[model samples]
Target chain A: MLNAIFSGDTPRSRPLTAILLVILVCLALGPFLFDGTRAFSTLGMICVFIVVVASYDLMLGYTHIVSFAHTMFFGIGAYGMAIATDAMGNNFTAILVGLAGAIALSVVLSLLLGLLSLRVKAIFFALVTLAVAFAFLSLATQLYNITGGEDGLRVRVPRELGPAFRPFDGELRGFSIVTFLSGLFTEPGNLGEVLRESVFKVRFSGRELMYYVAFVVSLLVFLFLLRMVNSPFGRVLQAIRENEFRAQALGYRTVFYRTAAVIVSAVLATLAGVMFALINRYVNPENTLDFQLMVFILLMCVIGGMGTLYGSVVGVALFLLAQNYLQDLLRLFAAQVPEGGVMAELVAPDRWLLWFGVLFVLSVYFFPTGIVGQLRIWSQRRKPAA
Target chain B: MSALEKTLDNKSARRERPWKALGKGPRARFAAFREEKPHLFLLALMMLVPLFMINPTTWAVLTISGLAMGAMVFLMASGMTLTFGLMNVLNLAHGAFISLGAFAGATVLTVWLNGYSGDSSLLVNLVAILPALGFALAVAGLVGLLFERLVIKPVYGDHLKQILVTVGGSIILLELIQVIWGPNEIPVPRPDALRGAFIVSDAIPLIGGIALEKYRLIAVLLGLAVYGLMTWVIDRTRVGVLIRAGVEDREMVEVHGYRIRLLFLGVFVAGSALAGLGGAMWAMYREIITAHMGDELMISVIVVIILGGLGSIKGCFYGAILVGLINLYVGFLEPRLAAVATVGLMVGVLMWRPQGLIPVIKV
Candidate 1:
């Protein structure tokens, strides 16, 4: 698929490549640019959402299948890791086992649901998947012995990947490798003490390591999906979406193709879930399998533009930026308002959802094609005029 | 001569078996019954569950509880069925109205606690309750009107846009509710006259001991009354015929000089009002109210409609009852399956009848 598209090495896509490069640079330097792990953590979250939402696009945008069970696959990934960490011990090998288990489980579940629901009307399929997802959520919460119930399970990250630690108890306590390295060349110390502390201090905090890992894996997943979407097989899925009967008449086995698409999408979602668990170091039903998360994914896809995979990137970035920063903006406005005044209510953080709701409605009303879609149309129109 | 002879023979054969005109044997009879009362078979099947459970008294108690719970669900779900059926509008924000109704009822009850306090007679308590119910219905209905005009009117035909817009509307409404109601779960105080249970040692000889909550009994009655009113409005009136006609063919009805748009708006408002009523009842049943209560309840309502068959009133009613029974029964039998039981029932029903348990004929 990559060979079919990017292999052409067309100069027209240079701008997109540049954009990707800039984003990569910004993400790699997130720790320094953002001043702390908080911003890095947010960026990591955005990365996770990007992967998951893009995977959602595979079904919704490409295959034209609307499903509510994406979160079920996501939850499968998180719970798989949670269970594996407890039983197999929190090692790199355990993570690998968890990933493989999650992938297999997601594929099977997606296949089963796709086959059963694809037999119905498209609308009915959505409803049925919703029912199935709710059932899965209930099962996860109810089976406390296996799933750890509603409180969720805290994953024991490998020591090197855990919180930053230090050797010396005084000023050096909680010092990390990043800080140590920065001061290493500036300060002089006893050779023996320096050597001893260097070995101990040369460890990445859990969050920092998880951020780098999530960023790279998300990029790989995105690129892989991009390849899949460009392949002939992907074209067949698109064909099924455009005209299932025509595809079937052409001997395309539409059901098999559709089911395969669902499996691929579900697998990607599960992979995203694994990254989420690694970064958060915990797994719970609400965070992973909740219906609200599914709604959020849907919202992101719609806002980003349904068919364009890159829109997932734009959508997640814009959404997270707004959700995270808008509160700060409101707080600034609130400071200008008198205490217990009418304007204060308007600028309250609790009312942020109200403003967001309005923004969402207005955006859908005005930009039905979404940001990427509108840009695509604008460019196409400009070409003819030029 | 041969054709005439054959015709005469066919006529003579038909005359010999006149029962064939009505239908053939038990299969035909059963088919007719199934068509007329599609949910009866399902109801009968569900009833057999208790026989397997083997504790008749427990079954009796559970059945009552199920009925009470089902009634609450029906009140909320019926409104959604009407709106979706008549308008083809998927109002995901319908839950917002339910929560609003609950809040409205709570406000009225709180403000009039004196009327509801102490050992007042049921009649006097009804005086206090009636006003709360009325306020909820009116306020919710008006809000529905506003919602229809501002949010729903612009995007009538597009299902995708409808979903997005309605979700946005729901979020806005939920947040507004928090702003007004103080972002916490408020306790709903039951009236003094409706607090205790009606205990019977020998109400039925087979069931030695039976206890039924007074409030639940009232809820069942109230739900039945609402159901009766809705059925009557839909089945027995000229407006009902017109609404049915509009659903069948809007253009044809418009050609006949009927304003279908007005009818649609009216139905939407009424549906919202019904949701509000249901919300009040549910708040009372739970004895607590939260802004997001309506949103959470929506999953069950959607499941009920799906199980009952979309656009089907009787199906919604029957489906609600089935869900209520399944939740209770499964919770008792296997606690793990309780949460998923309603969905499982939906899947099972769809497997047998893919269209739903009772597919409504739109025309």
Candidate 2:
């Protein structure tokens, strides 16, 4: 049953498995567990980005294809959602239409990209994709009448997905572990107080409902990726990555498989984009199609550990945690220092991307295998030398 | 030789001495030149776009500005191609250096050289700005050296790691630039001499009725000068010869007792300095500087290099000009479609020449 759920591939390390479980539970209980708007947004972003980053791993890690145009498909998906909803009204049908359109576009575009891209070497693929990404952005920006230009579009999610659309009459009562954890050390004997008095009122509303939607879809997609990777098709992809000429010599249509990989990955990424549009209720170039987002996705794939589906979970949780809480940490650190200097500016919240970027370089240098890889290594070492 | 053979095969050529045309040399030399640099004819063919597409005056002006833009791009791209050819390091953070130079030059021009920036004297403007450009170059080159050591040294032969680390470095450095310069766009101050267009009135004849910017002319000159110097050094100088030889066969050059590593380092630094210079020039051309400027230009720069063929200098030149002209021309003709068209042109070029305009080596 466990193997069936994991698609025959499991998180091999104890710590990794625990972390994955914790992330899954926390996200599954996010609205009930967390109160802050920023926390909710961050959670939603993490959920969406996990799928995006994981799909990218399918390309970069599994197939050794480095595409700077991952965000292009992402943008296309968001725009499709935004445009379709705008044209057809914010209903379930509109979403399905947008999603179907995005998928179709992604299929054709990724096929064209893969066909053109596989002809060139890896380096050329990166360069060409970068150019193509910019071209797409230009197209999006210029087609302002359709895409709303630089301002982007506010996607009117389905009425059921809207924040005000509560299913219940009032907020439903739930046990408040979040409150208990925060106050537990301060007041040890107040666990009952935290749970009783109906301390937390969890709304079975559309916003929380949207988070659950993102979570469930992400989980399903991640499992599907695991299944895909473990399949024979995946083995051929790995073989092609290892040695394309050898795979070709073995009579495998290498181009077909590589193109399939690109399409699968793109479809997943586009799905993530749809999730982004649904959750955020808005889609813009700056938000959906930023090149920096690609860097962040790359960071997730690298730090989580490449070629491991479970790594995306670890990566998304840690990076999102840092991105959200790092600012507070910096604020505390900066408070002790003098004002108006390079030190202050360096630690400014605006420069978080730099800190993460530095971490990316350091991780590439020092921890190329990443957290999951390292954990796997340590776990194997301890397990009777297995 | 093929042309010579064709002439020899003809009865007319058999009656006369075949060496007659060969002795005169200009026509044969032109043919040889055509054979050697087939893409130059492509460049010539593109140059003829203005004859039917647009008015002569507008065309001439656009061409000059386009060439100037190409010159700036060439400075940035030649460094990349040279480094790629010599060392096989892609250096995506080359854009970061450009950002560094722009900020450095912008600061210098607007602050330290403020007095001369507004001066009417052409010589004074040049004199004041030269130091700013130099300072920018120095700052960028020094950072490139550090970037190479910190981000690149570990991932010497791994293309994947090199690309990742370089990208990582680019983002970090761009952020660091913001940390220093603040996350805001800084307007570049142009000296009185460099400001405004030099209007060539119709009274001047065939080239009349065109307006050319003084800075653009200088940019074109500097670009041509750099191209000449690079070719000369590569063809003539010992270090250049060693670098070329290293590109062709590294072990052979090493066997001949030259430290290719030091030469590689030197080239890397020089390439970085060239990028810095280009950045400084670009800042002036746009009359604005921002942290993201280099990042924005990088898309076109990569396109230019790809079209030119990676790791080839002359190809970088023509590719830069072709991209610059295409962008400007199409932009002039049809607004908002330039970027897509540029990408389309890249795809078309790659299809025609999988390697590039100049075949450096197999990718």
Per-residue CA lDDT of model 1 for B1-363, tens digit only, reads 699999999999878555456776797677656555668877877878666874887887787788888888898888888787777887889889999999998888876654563346888787778888888888889999999999999999876678778888998888888877778899988878888888868746966667888888888898788888888888899888777777666678889998888988998999898889889888888989999899777877888888787677788889988888887787778879976878878777766677777766332
Q: Write model 2 residue lDDT over B136-215, tens digit each, in one string.
A: 88988898788777778788878888888999899999999998888989998778888778888878876796778889
Please give the range of 10 consecutive residues that has the lowest summed lDDT in model 2 chain B: B13-22
Q: Candidate 2: deviation at residue B204, Å?
A: 4.3
lDDT of 1 by residue, A12-33 (tens): 3334446556666767766544
Residue runs of model 2 more than 4 Å from their true location after superposition: A175-177, A189-198, B1-38, B204-206
Query: How well is each residue in A1-386 modelled by candidate 2, as lDDT tens digits?
Result: 99898887888889888888888888887777676688789989989998999999998888888888999999889999999999999899999999999999998998888878766776788889989999998899888999999999999988788878987886576555666676776677876765564266676778888988899999899888999999999999999888989999999998899889999999999999998999998988898888877778888888898888788888888998998899888888788878898999988877888888888888888888888988988898898746
Interface RMSD of 1: 2.6
Provide TM-scores for the models.
0.87, 0.93
| Residue pairs in clash, model 2 | none
Candidate 1 ranges with C-alpha deviation above 4 Å = A1-22, A164-207, A236-253, A341-343, A381-383, B1-36, B112-119, B201-203, B361-363
For model 2, give the RMSD to the true fold. 4.8
